[model samples]
Target: MTLGNFSRVTEFILLGLSDTRELQILFFAFFFLAYAMVLLGNLLIIVTVKADPKLSSPMHFLLCNLSFIDICCTSVTSPRMLVDLLSQRKTIAFEDCIAQLFFLHFVGATEMFLLTVMAYDRYTAICKPLRYTVIMSRQVCWVLVFACWAGGFLHSIVQTLLTIQLPFCGPNAIDNYFCDVPPVIRLACMDVHVTEWLMVSNSGLISLVCFLVLVTSYTFILVTVRVRFTEGHWKALSTCASHLMVVTLFFIPCIFIYLRPFSSFSSDKHICVIYTVFCPVMNPLIYTLRNNEVKASMWKLWQRYVEGRKRTVTFPGDTDHCILPAINSLLQYTSVIISTMKDKMHKVNTSTVSEFILIGLSDAPEVRFFLFVLFLIIYLVTMASNITVFVAISTDTRLHNPMYFFLGNLSLLDILCPTITVPKMLEVLLSENNVISFSGCILQLFFLVDVVGTEILLLTVMAYDRYVAICQPLQYVNIVSMKLCARLAIGTWVVGFFNSLLHTSLIFTLFFCASNEVEKYYCDIAPVLALSCLPTYSRELVILTVAGVLGSSAFVVTLVSYVYILLAILCMNSAESRHKAFSTCSSHLTVVCLFYGTTICTYVRPSSAYSPDQDRIVSMLYGILTPLLNPIIYSLRNKEVKCALGRVISQVRTTLTK
Candidate 1:
């Protein structure tokens, strides 16, 4: 069918679980907490399984994959559902609905097949102990995982193709939180009886076959255990119990929903929540609480972290007692600043504007397309490299020192900085829809300021770390205790939050009646302030004052630390020692120069000096290019990071080939 004949509806309204305001609020809180738990629990499992040498078995490997799938599956629907529960309109665009349907089934079916494979794994380990290793070797495990993913892809493509080609000329209300095969197929313009049955057979038969196989595998394993009646048998049975519980929770909901025609039964939406929301939340809890090995590994990891925190060094005449008072005074001053800003905002005149137009990078179509592709590649590489560094530092205990800890924070900031701006820029480039609501503009500026401010403080702290490591080598461990590191990290974030809040509150309080066109692709302080009708002298003065104090202080500290570091390096008798010392700081110094150079050029100048074209290029250097280069700089220059990354890569390779 042509585009005109495909569908008349541009979007679909979702009637979520309830219409009552009280019920919606309650459900929102419930699901928000549940989603947070699902993410944290599954991530902990993945990290623990990777970090601990004790969890190198094939069973644990499969469990790690299962945890990853749980995260992917829940993320597909939970975020959208949570947003809808809070939203009044609760609508999804036509293309978004179809994409959701595709990934929902793709990851869902993949999990089902993986669970069945885990069942088979258990059966071999228990019933065929003599040949278990031979049968379920590393190569065989890789093949099984590959097969599961391939099967899931095939299954999802068939469903998506069938549903996408159907004509939905009108009536685009879906009576559930998300898009799915049955509910979506029911909305077709033509009769869907044949399509419904075909989809049902496709989904239902797979669930049934997997369910039956799991059942038979468990049954045989149980019988074998009863006959053998050994200590090893008892342990295997305990492991099987966790898997069985997960299997029961997951498959029962799949069978109940798919093994029928498309109908709007009252229980349909509720049952969908079981496999979609409940299963992912419960999987980690079931495995960790029931399986001894996982529990032990988690406990060890926690103990190590706690022990590191507790090993604080004490020195004679130390002023540690004064630290708490200083922090308390700082917090009190911040509260006063916030209150003063609120009062000032209330006194200012409010504007009538609701949205602003963003004049993107270029007007030509080809230029826009080129920018889109360029930024898209940058965004992907930034995310991949930063996530690799973050995960490497997290999962490898060797990289647990203060330097890597700060580097991990830097990686996280790199991830957040680009994520705050790039996706919207990509959308604007692709669709030429450059209008942003007032609230979105405020949020974008707020988070951008927060990440940048946090990075400033974090870099200063990292420089201090290097100074201590180089200048006070004997006292490095005692001075940079994990507790102090944690406190410093928290302090940076807290200060950054207040700093961003103060600037955002101050800027938005001014009336914005002059113009609605933002000169840059994304919202920033200079552009937004330039659009204000009222005199921005007070805001500008405040920005200058704060930037001077904070920026100068951080720069002085970093500069002084590096100066001392250079002196210490030059004084070293061994050339080899000097080279090693400087190598450790090179990556951070390069990043510092890139970040501060672009930031100072853009923000330190008066608003009257702002050139739109020049400002955009400068902003991209700090906002986009810096994040893309940070991890590459660290990975290439830092030997320990390289080794940790190598170990992570080799572990994955070994898993696939051993």
Candidate 2:
């Protein structure tokens, strides 16, 4: 069977769900927006996972993989289909058809089985608590993830092989769009009964097993939750509940569509939409919304956005206030808690952040003195608090581990990240003529670049730190020694500083110093890059090259590290040890979720969709809120930190008692 003997057809027509003109327009607009959302959403997952240290787990590793999958899987057909819907052409070539079918099924099935494997991971951690480490050893996790990919590969290869062998010499028009096996096989001139059965056996059978395993995994997981009910089992149940909801939503429709032969199904088109388009659309929402942890992180992120608006009172100049329905609709589908989503909103002037207008009761000149006095107290507290933290970490002999080292670096970054933007922003707000010079803008650009880039690099390094500590606990001391910690921390700053140099330098090269208005609340690259009056090719290449290179590498490293961590966690024996291992890593997982969710959301597009308004919103998380949350989460949620704090408090109380 010579492959090119396969006729090199130009293109084949896609018989999409609707041929009606109005419906076509409607679908085109709808899917176009959805495609954007899909890109934005998946990108968000990657960034958040990469940036926030909390999400450093095997599950998040798989999640980041799935996000990449969703983007890749949906990209295969959606954009083209949307484009075709708007154009006269609606055809796919035979080879392209085969490619589409393979990618769709391979990524789709890989995601399905990956979900099952994740559930089993949850079950083993919960139910077989004692032997979890040994059971889910690093080797086992690789085997599991490999099995998933291998299984998807084999399944897709078999299906594609079976389909290609059939005679499709007639009726190139495919119904309900795309190169699906059922519809593609239906076009076969020869009898596809045998191939159909094979499809049923492989596709249907795999779905069945995955469904069963998910069910069984949840069942045992339920029992484990019951045993731990007295311990406020809400967290465990919430995790299980979220996974079940997403899995059921993902597999139920899939099972229904492919379970039987391609017979009379009145809703095939709708089912296909649910499985293909909606599944990817809903996944991020399901994961983010249902889990309280994700919801909390997102809420924290949203708060930053709200604060950004308050500080930048001029608001974004180019914001499309229209179609707020998209986010509203998203809220309907997601579990992000709305009430806690925003408060204490503050605005900053992005255009001239050289010196901020001081907050005073200047509306009434008599009260100006009182206002200044009130704010002076807060300013002092803010500086003192930050200085105290910096000093404590720098001086404390005991606070010298990789963990504390990272924490100190973060505090130092946070102390500086806000200082560069905030005070200047305040000064501009106070005086009528408060404005910044070119040198000031350039300085601001440098620090802003360093702050964001360093944070991203630091978050990735922290994930690696967590991976070493949790996965290689026995060797953690040797592996992540003080010298190593110093080196990693220094490496994070070095990479970030250099990356920022490329980004800031490229933007400055093209952006004329004459265009004084910076159309953003903070000195972010996307909006600044947008400000360039010159050709954007070089600027884009540099900005994206640096951000993309750093972002991609961070994501890959985080994902790979989690895979090993999952393997290590799974290998533990004895429930107590397993619980402790996972527990120790939980904070890191949470932070990773926050970091990846925000950063990926901000950067992972083609650089064309970087809206100043949306960029500011996403940047808030990727830069500000996430870094802030890092210390809060690690300090509040981590027992070690809590113990350390308690020890400090106890000493103070003892002195008071004396």
Which candidate gets the maximum lDDT versus the true structure?
A: 1
Task: Put down candidate 1 lDDT per residue, 284-398, tens digits, no spaces.
Answer: 9889867769978997899787778657643334345546666788789878976776576556736777798988999999999999999999999999989989999999999
Tell me the deviation in Å of residue 327 in model 2: 46
Query: In candidate 1, what residue range of length 10 has the lowest lDDT sum?
Result: 313-322
Q: Look at candidate 2 and tell me the lDDT of residue 90.
A: 84
Cα lDDT tens digits, model 2, 597-621, are 7776675443455666666566656
Q: Model 2: runs farther than 4 Å from truth?
A: 1-9, 12-178, 182-382, 433-443, 466-473, 509-516, 533-658
Query: Which candidate achieves the best TM-score against the true structure?
Result: 1
Candidate 1: misplaced stretches above 4 Å? 1-5, 307-323, 334-658
TM-score of each: 0.52, 0.48
